[model samples]
Target: MNINGDYHVHTAFCPHGSNDKIEAYIEQAITKGLTELSFTEHAPLPKSFSDPTPDKDSAMKWADLDQYIQTIEKVKKDYQSQLKINLGFELDYIEGYESAITSFLNDYGSVIDDSILSVHMLKTNMDDYVCVDFSVEEFARIIQLFGSVEAVYDRYYQTLEKAIVADLGPYKPNRIGHLTLIHKYQRKYAVDQGYQFTIERLLDIMKKNKLELDVNTAGLYKEECLELYPPQAIVDLASQKGIPLKPGSDSHTAKTIARGFNKLSLLTNN
Candidate 1:
């Protein structure tokens, strides 16, 4: 696969990611023969939302927002001749925080070159939530709260569907990230339900909305999920519908850029 760009990448700004410099990531992309890369660092959560994970490092600090952009701007100027660098954020789509998200986009969206809307935190109750892929213990707790592996999967798809159709102003990200992130630990808590109908519904809505699919490769490295997000079968279905499938490494470290490019059969076929 002649991969040209990686649309979803984290940076030193991410609290949960490595402290590798932004320049290092750009150098890695250039070394891997990628012409373009987007630093989709996790945006700060809404003020009303509380961090549920143990360490509470799922996203970046609000105080660092400006510096994050400025740092990127500096690196972008330096690497302009060598690579096409994009400034972006991986915004979370918490179900009840639409207004906050909209306000945020309105304030900063003008400068963003590319971005992604993703669902990392799942609401289990009116106020309580859980970070879906935080840890295996957390996944177990999520199953206990939702009552089963099936219910958790159902809620994830349902939330993703809502995210696809929700109105978050003009700055809303065009890419729907990691469509099957809930399967990150499927080997341990595998469910019997196929969720074919729900998956198809999501694809249909994505097609209608003209949203891009982030065919994330991070799941392939997860010990439990030895396949692509949405897997190949679902990838084929998206291809049949003519949805744009862009590969993303979801790399937390600079060395991980284009980590699984060869596994992208859709890119190869094209």
Candidate 2:
């Protein structure tokens, strides 16, 4: 047995979730006979929607996250016989969002065992979009000015570079979530073929900084990649550097947990 561990599990603390109470999920994992259970709730963000003029509501759901942690602590004792539970959070990054990322991270980082840096929507104009690192108006303005297909790619890749390189913390990351899944949306060029332009730099950056990425297999569930990010070449390079590895399904639902991890493991082990 692989000692089945699920580290990317989320809970109702995120706006995108419901009924994901850590205790309930932990119990479910025990039912499934899981060996190790971890809860990595979404990282906290600032209140952009509470500007009063535009009461769009916050991008993420509101909850007593600290209390949620305390609740997990309370429940852990009950599940001690079935599974070992750990705590973590999935952090998002934007250039300006650094302060919020840093603030919340500093407050909570020490308390948790690990954190992951995931760049969600690539900051769009929609205030509701998790990708609010940059203004959507700016993305449109560039499109209108340049009007070249390559220009859009240039901007997107540049933005991604910033996100990947952003100053995170004392620990680089336990595992990287969907590395290039962003291409499923905005990528103009074939990600694998054209990724060199992006990877050539990011590879060196991750290597120099000693960062390792994940082999996220959830893409099989979403029908995106044959698997998820960092492509084969990147995986090879990371292996060469002796960078660490973490296999994840990025499971949102209990059913999606480690869904395609078997095939994903074979691909990355090369």
Candidate 3:
């Protein structure tokens, strides 16, 4: 509960994120008294997987991978005296691309200090996928693709379960990012209470795998989702299950670093 670390963060390298300099994020974290921060920028999607987002900005460009790594390495050295900067990625768990993900992790995992495996893309059909949190319009379209809001929720949670148990090699991230991200538009689409059973099952599997939960605060700030990802009930369940709860603002801009930290029960209780 003595929250001093933010394990989920994005950087300027993210095409969908701000153009803020990397140093700006570190400065903000230091100003906020955070001792540890991970620049878990979105990693590049697999070569064979076509990005479903309209702008195709879901992840960093494959061309920028090397430069991103080198820049973070230098930044790590520069800030080592003041902060613990982690080099990491917010990796997507595409159902069919496990091998490519494994290959990627095998190549770069050793250098990372922290990372998160998240589900942003959900397959809707044989060769088609949808970025579930892209926008209200996109969410509407996906609901149509899957035939209902409930079906979308079902598929999203199913994918999350698959990501948890799948063997993406030994370097697979131990933290599951934003477990209830499918609820991003809950105010608009309204989720049924039935999903609670599925969530409890997820926590069971997470405990089995010794996985951590990213108690993401970004959802609290989103107008459509005025609660933490998984909300308080699930957070309590995760805590009772002895799964580590790591607070993350999931900030995309430097100014938003530690954005909703104070509201976190983990922080408030302590």
Candidate 4:
């Protein structure tokens, strides 16, 4: 896995991630042997988000975002010799909330390099959705109830199907994040046959629709379900289907960038 780009990254702006400056992430990526990297901080639908978000006071502080962007632009100019740093964000899914995302994106839509739409939650009121991190407790509950890889796959992909229908269009995503991360804490919960078959069907759908995916390494950070999104079988199917793939860390913290890449290589080798 010659991982070239760290497309999924977060900084202080995301509230939950490291408080390090944007330049810190760029430097770390360069040291990790990245050729390209995009800074995709959490861009939540302000109104849809909780007033006091888990990590910050509000969804996304526009002030911090502007400063972060400015820092990235300046550092890109200053370093000039490092990776091709880009500005993008993990735009949370809001059903009718596309307008909010679209409006913000419109400013940079012309020149911005990339964007990733992630459905952090399954259900929402109205069309508006905000990126909400699954609490460890909630994740544990989900796993306890639906962690069987088969159950996890069923729900996650179904949600993904809805997302593809509602969110993805015109601007096709550069890559899908943590395709099978719902199983991260519950590999034992995932059964073999049903999970595999269902994911195969989803890969077929993505292939038919011509979507690219990132082979995420974030699962390794967890104690279980150490494979990338949609699992290895899905990845193989996607490969067979001619979907382009790029390795992504889904790095929420600065230290773990590019961690556990070997696990992905093992899957690829087999």
Candidate 5:
């Protein structure tokens, strides 16, 4: 598995991730023989929106964006000779806040070397955003609100389709993060339909837009998912379609720098 770079990684700035410093992650990446590492901490959210998680601290403070950028820039310089460090943010795609997100990206996107555009939250009938991967209880709540698991899947994929077409100026992310993140708890609450149509639509959109797919391995380590995100079949299809696939650890801690990368290599090889 000659995985050279990891594009999706979080740091202490991300409240949901470990408190480890960027240096710790850089060291770990060096140990794993990764040539490039990108610090893609979760992008700050708007004040009007609130996450429905129990902790309510999934993202960094909006004011801290400058500090986050400065820190990563310094680290990138410090390790310029040893490893390649790219600066970016894992921006979430919320339905109604496209303009706000685009504005933010326009301001900071120029400095970003790489980024992952992800759909982590969906709007409920109540007009509030709720996390799709927070917990099984939350997922069930969403399913109940939508009247069924398939309906939730429909909404999720629909939001992703919008994300694919969103305009974030010239700095729009070139990669889609964790294409099947909504399936984090598939083992607990299975959907009857295969979602092949949705997958095909997403792939087609990516192909047309020249967007890449994040072949994230984080799902394989999750207790419920127990499979690589997008699964093997999707990867094979993307390969056939010539949609570029970029492997990401989606690391929340220094210890998880390259988790499941070997499995990804094996899967892609076969």
Candidate 6:
């Protein structure tokens, strides 16, 4: 694989990630022969966004946004000659909060060079937002409430559709992160059928909006999901539909930089 960049990565600013310095990831990317790296720390949510059990340690606080941008901007200049660094955020798309999210992007989007829009949380039957990627136990519990894995998949894709069409002004993300992130626990709760219609609709939206797909490899490392996100079949379909694809390690730790890139190469080769 002739990988040139990694567009999804986190720093110590993300509480869920390791407390490694931003420089540590840059050093690792350089060692791995990557010329570009984007620090897409998870964007912070507003207080009004309901979280029954808030994972305060997951994302950076809204107050830290300034420091986070300053840190990346300074390092970007410092590494200009050695590597290309981009300032971006991994924006989470939650229903009923589009206005707040859009306002945030409108305020900072001009300064951002890249971004990965993702769906990490979904409204449950209980009408509260819960993380879909937190843990297998949580996933299992949520699926039971929905009655089946297929119901969960349906809702996930529907939410993704809304995310793709969302107008975050001109700075809306150009890339969709982990198209099948709902399958993070595939080994435990496999759906009987692939949501082909939903996937096709999403592809059409991306094609029309000129958005790209994050060929995320983090799932391969997860014991529950032994394949790359969105599955190989979806990748093939996206390739056929002319949807652009970018490799994202989704690295939360330094050691995970560019992990499972060989699998990404295989997708392109075919």
Predicted structure with the largest lDDT when compared to the true one: 3
Q: For candidate 2, lDDT tens digit of each residue in 1-270?
A: 142766667776655566565666776677666788767777655544222112332223446676767866776787788888777777665546666666677677777875566765434434323332133443345445445435555555666567667775654454555566554434322323465657667656665665556656655544333535656566666666666556555665666655665554443322
- Taking all chains together, each candidate's TM-score versus the true structure is 0.97, 0.74, 0.97, 0.80, 0.95, 0.94
lDDT of each: 0.90, 0.58, 0.91, 0.62, 0.87, 0.86
lDDT of 5 by residue, 99-175 (tens): 88888888887799999899988988888878888889878888988999988988899999999998867888899
lDDT of 1: 0.90
* TM-score: model 2 vs. ground truth: 0.74
Cα error, candidate 1, residue 116 (Å): 0.6
Model 1's number of clashes is 0
Q: Backbone clash tally for model 6? A: 0
What is the Cα-based lDDT of residue 257 in candidate 3?
92
lDDT of 3 at 19: 93
Q: Is candidate 3 or candidate 6 better by lDDT?
A: 3
Q: Regarding lDDT, does 2 or 5 come out ahead?
A: 5
Instruction: By lDDT, rank the candidates, best first.
Output: 3, 1, 5, 6, 4, 2
Model 2: lDDT of residue 55: 32
Candidate 2 residue spans exceeding 4 A from truth: 1-3, 27-34, 48-62, 123-153, 169-174, 186-193, 224-226, 266-270
Q: After superposition, which runs of candidate 4 have C-alpha atoms over 4 Å from their true positions?
A: 49-59, 124-133, 140-153, 167-169, 187-193, 266-270
Clashes of each: 0, 4, 0, 14, 0, 0
**Can you list the residue pairs that collide in candidate 1?**
none
Report the alpha-carbon TM-score of model 3 versus the true structure.
Answer: 0.97
- What RMSD does each model have against the real structure? 1.5, 5.2, 1.7, 4.1, 2.0, 2.0
Q: Candidate 3, residues 106-127: lDDT per residue as tens digits?
A: 9999887888999999977666
Q: What alpha-carbon RMSD in Å does predicted model 4 have with respect to the real structure?
A: 4.1
- Per-residue alpha-carbon lDDT of candidate 4 for residues 188-236, written as tens digits (9 for 90 to 100): 4445654566666766776666666767777665656555655666666
Model 4 Cα shift for residue 112 (angstroms): 2.1
